[model samples]
Target: MERTLHLRLTCGLLASAARLTPVPFLDDFLGDRARRLMVDKTLSAHGRRFPSKQVAPLYADPHGCLYGCLLSAVKLLLFPVKKVLTWLFALRYLTRDLSDAVLLGRALDGWLEAGRLADATDPPARLQEASLLRSAFDNAVAGTDMQLLQGLLMKALRGVSGLPKAAWHAVRRLRRGGAGADPTEGLSQADDDAMKRGTAKLGAALETPEARAFLEAFDARLAENVRILEARHASG
Candidate 1:
């Protein structure tokens, strides 16, 4: 029964996706439609498998799925806008005449440390330097502390101890017509590359036993949540 329901939901989503036409800023319509169809079909299938008196839970599942799908889709659509805003703010901050390189350095250090904790890996010292450089670029965009910002950024590039040679190479490449000589331009390009690499790494890592176990646990929780909703509907 679950297999049949899953297949039906998948087909519904695909059909919705196929029906959408591509357009700038409106591409999410297709994904949104697909997500809605998936949720609706899943609930409908559940309703058919159970009697009308027992269909309340299935309806609740669809409701929850609909909200989750919409939130996810909206977030995905807004990600590009957020990146652009980040770049704009960073550029504005870099062209100023403020003097707080030391403070900026501390902030960058803390941010890098937090990133390391999140990733559970000891990234090279160069990563922290990269973080500071990136921060300086952001500060310039935000139009704050231009002199101090540049000083902090240069310090990050040169004085930051243990910076990876590869990072310096990448920075040099950016400076040498890799992209716009603008700091934001180089930062954006590097970010894109990093995202691509991170995604690839995550895909590979998900194949490990630990990742598989985590996925299994997550799936179990999802199923339990659905069942609980179903029970509430039944009781109502």
Candidate 2:
């Protein structure tokens, strides 16, 4: 989903009022490595027909964990030594793929809602909500970006095979329902002090009336999202 952001900056003040989108193209979240794992899979054998180049994907549905397990078992039988890593990759990705998509969409929605309360919005956020923003969020809630979610998870666990201690820590984080010190702590290592300073600068802009309201509500909103994800995991 998308919306045109119109802004006129003049002499340090937003003349036409700055309508900024804080998040980037969002599709940027999933890099190439994970995308390949989630969307593409090479078949071990020919199709039900004779040998052919056409190989359908192993796991296309995010919520299909059982299916992923079965696929993994099948791959294991055909090529134990050569495909262990790829099998693990698919299994790990599909485990929380669907649920994580909802979680990510919720995060993005929270960002916009949080941002709307940041300052006085151009058209006034109190008026009916922005249509484009609503569409974007609606799609997000529908789990439209499974590849992005799966790819990101794959990236976070990237070197786990070589680092047993880190792998255990990652497991602990997941088993604790992701509610520890840093709910999204895995991503924090990617942030540098310079990035922190840049973020602080950007955060300073939230001083306006629209955005100010979100500060008070932010923590509660975040907690709610965590609970939602945890609850979904528990039920499954």
What's the count of clashing pairs in each model shown?
A: 23, 8
Please report, in order, the local distance difference test score of every candidate based on alpha carbons.
0.34, 0.30
TM-score for each model: 0.25, 0.22
Q: Highest lDDT, which number?
A: 1
lDDT by residue (65-139, candidate 2, tens digit) is: 586567765644545443444344544533243223324333434544454312244333322233323333334
RMSD of 1: 21.8
lDDT score, candidate 1, position 148? 39
Task: Write candidate 1's Cα lDDT for 194-227 as tens digits.
Answer: 4234333334444456545544443344335435
Those runs of model 1 whose alpha carbons end farther than 4 Å from true positions after fitting are: 1-25, 33-203
Residue pairs in clash, model 2:
117-210, 117-211, 118-210, 118-211, 118-212, 119-210, 119-211, 120-210
Q: Count steric clashes of candidate 1.
A: 23
